[model samples]
Target: MKHFHMLLAVLTLIIFVCQALPIWMGKTAKRSAMITGASHLIYTLLMLTGLWLFWQLYQVAGVQHWAIAKLVLLVVAVSATIKALRNQAVQPSQAKAGMMIAAVGYVGILYLAMAKPLLG
Candidate 1:
């Protein structure tokens, strides 16, 4: 069950990256970007649900560092999505940089979750 949840989370992350890259690269139109943003939102919700289910089933003690990092990355992703949706104009280079940073943050969270390395 934990593995299943992890898989779902990975899938969600992949979808998010796919949806974000086109916008960040200035390849997607405003309308299409909005649509993709909505899709990402839905995928994120699903991923969270999977994580919740895994926790309930496994009764695993939460990893504080992993959870906090994941939440921070999620917040960045949400903020980027909102900003992208609000502005129809092509994203400026700065916004693209932010998007790339958020992507890296997301990957970091995933790696921390999987690796569970000592934080010291």
Candidate 2:
């Protein structure tokens, strides 16, 4: 489950990059039907697997602070990606900023998941 979750995370990041790069380059990002479909599927799987893993962790350790932080990071990442991808009216600069925010969110989530640091 962990490996699968990791794979989904990577796929989600790749999709975000693919969708964001063209907009960042000042080009209209016209996503193909396949990429769009795959992205939706990947996002759904990622959320389900993530929740399951969180539940498993909670059962073992009783709601770690880092886990809650990770959930917040996940929201940040996904919300930014959606804001950048869905709105055609968004300026290129804004889109770039959104993607950067999402990248940071993803990095933070990954770090928290891997390190499992003790937090207050």
Candidate 3:
């Protein structure tokens, strides 16, 4: 289950990068990533699998601050990604800011998962 969760996370990362490529590399083909059924599917699976994995972990080790923090970060990251992809009418700079926020959120999620600090 953990492996599956990690796989989905990696796929989400790749899809996000692809979607953001239009801003980063100035290629229009990558813009197709913004509104694809595939992107939606990937996000759905990533979220569901992550929740499933968290449930299983919670059963074993009980809840921790890192787990809660990671879940919150996941919400923010996905929200940022969705906003970034959906804002076609906004200025390109604003859209780019959304993408950066998403990326940072994802990094925070990953870091929390790995560090798993048991905050008091």
Candidate 4:
């Protein structure tokens, strides 16, 4: 279970890094965004499976906040990717903002998972 969780985390990190790379390189962001979104979808499924397995094996309630936040961010990521792909002329600022929000949410999710802070 631990190994599975670690692998999921690593994969998610890779997806995030890959998604952000094109922006830093000043290339066509849409292509990379699509790839990143797809990677995120894969990561989400894997993470869900890992969480279910962990719960089944250890009866431990995982970080629900992080999981929920991640799902929300993934939705935003997908939406942004779709919009960018459809309208190549869309302002880069909009895409950048969306990506920034998604990245911030991802970081928040990681913090919540690591700290397990009390959820009011």
List per-prediction Cα lDDT, in the order shown.
0.63, 0.86, 0.76, 0.60
List, residue by residue over 6-32, the lDDT tens digit for candidate 4: 677667667666655565455554555
**What TM-score fits each model?**
0.63, 0.88, 0.83, 0.63
Rank the candidate models, highest lDDT first.
2, 3, 1, 4
Give residue 76's error in model 3 in angstroms: 1.0
Give me the overall lDDT of model 4. Answer: 0.60
Candidate 1's TM-score: 0.63
lDDT of 1 by residue, 5-111 (tens): 56766666766676567666776534466657666666676557755764663466545555555666767766765565455255466556666766777778678
Candidate 4 clashing pairs, residues 3+ apart or interchain: none
**2-54 per-residue lDDT for model 2 (tens digits):** 99999999998888888877877878789799998998899899989988998
Model 2, C-alpha of 2: deviation from truth (Å):
1.3
Backbone clash pairs for candidate 3 read none
All candidates in order of TM-score, best leading: 2, 3, 4, 1
Q: Can you tell me which runs of candidate 4 are displaced by over 4 Å? A: 30-41, 53-89
The prediction achieving the highest TM-score against the true structure is: 2
Model 3 Cα lDDT, one tens digit per residue, 30-84: 4454457777887788778878877888899887778778878878888877776
